[model samples]
Target chain A: MATQDKREDILRAAEKAPLLSPSAQRLLQITSAREHELMEIVAVVKCDAHLTVRVLKIVNSAAFGLLYPISSIDRAVSYLGERMVVGIALNDCAAHLFDKQLDGYESERGSLWRHDLQAAIASREVAQRARVEINPDLAFTAGLLHDLGKALISDYLRGTCAGLLAEIEQNQVADYLEGERHLIGIDHTEAGSALARNWKLAEVLQMAIAHHHNPGAAPPEHRPLVYAVHLGDIIAMMGGCGTGADTLRYPLDQGYGAFFDLGGEDLAAIMLDVQEEFAKIDTSLAETKEN
Target chain B: MSNIIIGIGDLGASKGQDDILKTFALGSCVAVILLDPKQRAAGMVHIALPEAKINPAKAQERPGYFADTGIPALLREMKKLGCQPNARGLMVKLAGGAKVMDPNDTFNIGKRNILAAKKALWAFGLGPVAEDVGGNFSRTVAISLATGDVILSSPGRPNWKL
Candidate 1:
């Protein structure tokens, strides 16, 4: 197939990728609202039985270390807090998509899911430390979905893994994304953006997924969120969470530190926090798997 | 046999012959493996940064996060496991410390990590007997307590002894 045709096919497949569940959509809407009313979020979460059950399971999980078993959605929401409840709900919804093996990228089963969670946590931390103007929830969501394209394009790459690896070695391709572009005519960033558009995700999220590898390419309006996700991805990789074949292939954008006015000390602090946060998440994930 | 995973900013040591100490996806970070062929003990530390002075608090909290602190910490733990300091029984191998990105060496964290690992080893009057370092690839390294062998694996590449 011609490169352009292959690109179009991948885009079509991405567009046809599974849409967000109704519960996830509602949770996203509730969390993304400008004004957060706990009651409003609670009402939205209660409408979805699966989301409610999953949220309860998470709160009651051994990792959460809750002192009491919570039987009701209200109690679970109140105990876990609104942001965590929303994150849990969305993660459950998205797990089916990201939890599979991505062998083309040399990722084991659940690697992408773990990476997304780590990046999401890191994004929130970066936003807080950098004092970026974007909402923390938006930054987290964008970070979680920034690599959605990898899931979309995994099948296509599986067939060409051997050849692509050779080309990458022979040409010294900068990273997997560059190799992806050379072999498939479109990179994960573009495919992820397309997936976001198909899911009708917020424009900021689409932009972040599209430009996370190159935040400078993002429009001015979306730069803050894009930059947050970009930094979060790097932080996740550095912390050794869910790294695959593309790990360490992307260069650190030095401009990001200058743009955010983040000194080395600031980054170190954020990294420390990210390590702690990821440790907690990993424990919870392990508990979930055990159950 | 179980594998003890050394995460980023962390280190692990095993005294049991059935245990394998391993670290994965070493990008710019370096994995320092120390083994005692006589005692059949192995230790691995995943060092992310070279110096600790920049973040003294972090260094104090996570000694395995920086080379200066991590190397000494690993040595201490290995000593507890009956690994000696002498050159006859103890063997060292280094893997990772790749400039995976930034061909221009703009950040150069990998190069710095390699240098720091060597410097710290020199403080102990030691050096790597075998090294597989400095490249554009990520590596997974493991040391077998039973065999005292260090193995390096990467994507699209065959696994080999270091």
Candidate 2:
């Protein structure tokens, strides 16, 4: 009934959320390490026969159009790299959250998956241009999972996306996040932060899920990764891949300038690149889910 | 009865009276609708950016992605349907150029897209007859080739003629 009561109910729902598959948990743990080797990811996949086949199938599955099909898991892991491997692991585990419709956002089924996929690709591209050394793979992983909380909140916000849009239109609230908080006790970022902790996700990832919409508020150490995901989410919206109602309603922190060396022109370039990459993976990953 | 759906960086045209030119979820992207008033042939281009220099290779592959090129590309599509567009006979409508509540966003692409679409139209001795652009919400557009009615709709909002 009350906003706080709703927030508590949402948090309790998150606490009961399904855990990521063991392989996915391992991938996140190793990828977040400072000096991890690629073999660490390969080892994790090797342990899960189902995940191993998904990885190999994606690499050879016309997605890459490899002339010679290599049957080795090690070669497949190296071929697609850590980011795609991480994506396969997580999607295998958390796809119900990723693929669910965001009725609250007025989005249809698969909208969240497409947005997160584009954000993941865009975040990886943005990280590649970071002024300081940072883990681009981790950025990709965080982007893919940043919007997980929206699915959790969608049921509660259903049938009210219009009123929220009007609130944004009249400038009664600064943006959708404000509208979300004003109506509900918490926004997607706060709800997602709870899920990240509930699942015992890596610390940097929790910061990313929490502060992606407002990276400047993130702690100084995790700011670079958070900023990468922040810009990535905006790029996905700009490229016309956002979830339905609340497409580009969040603020883009100008403070990201301190973390990355991207110019206005770079945003356009990243968007085009994201479009190209998204096309390549859209059907390929859909097949992964069906399998 | 039928729809010629245009995606970002994509364009389509139809001479059939049963056709509707449509584009969806236009966040910051701008959709340029061209209808030959006499022939009733219609076309649409979904433009994502103002200029091509940002990615020349992409412009070459999908000219509809940039406003400067998208306007001309849509015009070329109209010509393919054997309908020539003149300043007086052409019905032009522009929709979508929404911001995300951040006025200071250096990349206020919606505004930039509107300006560029206008500049590109003027270069071809054309201008919009009707437009609904610049807001903080995404738009979906449908142009009826049967009736010449341009319907602009936003999520949870009533559809209105542009």
Give the top-scoring candidate (DockQ).
Answer: 2
Q: What is the DockQ of each candidate?
A: 0.43, 0.62
Candidate 1 docking band: acceptable
lDDT of 2 by residue, A81-153 (tens): 9999998888878988998988888887988989999999999999999998778999999999999999888
In model 1, residue pairs whose N, Cα or C atoms come closer than 3 Å (at least 3 residues apart or on different chains), thus clashing, are none
Q: Which ten residues in a row have the lowest lDDT in candidate 2 chain A?
A: A282-291
- Give the Cα error of residue A97 in candidate 1, in Å: 1.8
Q: How far off is residue A181 in model 1, in Å? A: 2.2
CA deviation > 4 Å runs, candidate 2: A288-291, B85-88
Candidate 1 per-residue C-alpha lDDT over A108-145 given as tens digits, one digit per residue, 9 for 90 to 100? 78788778888988888887766547777778878788
Judge the docking of candidate 2 as incorrect, acceptable, medium or high. medium
lDDT of 2 by residue, B1-162 (tens): 887788888999887899888998888899998888787788889999999888788888899999998888888878878776554478888999887556475778788899999999999888898899987678889988888888998766678889
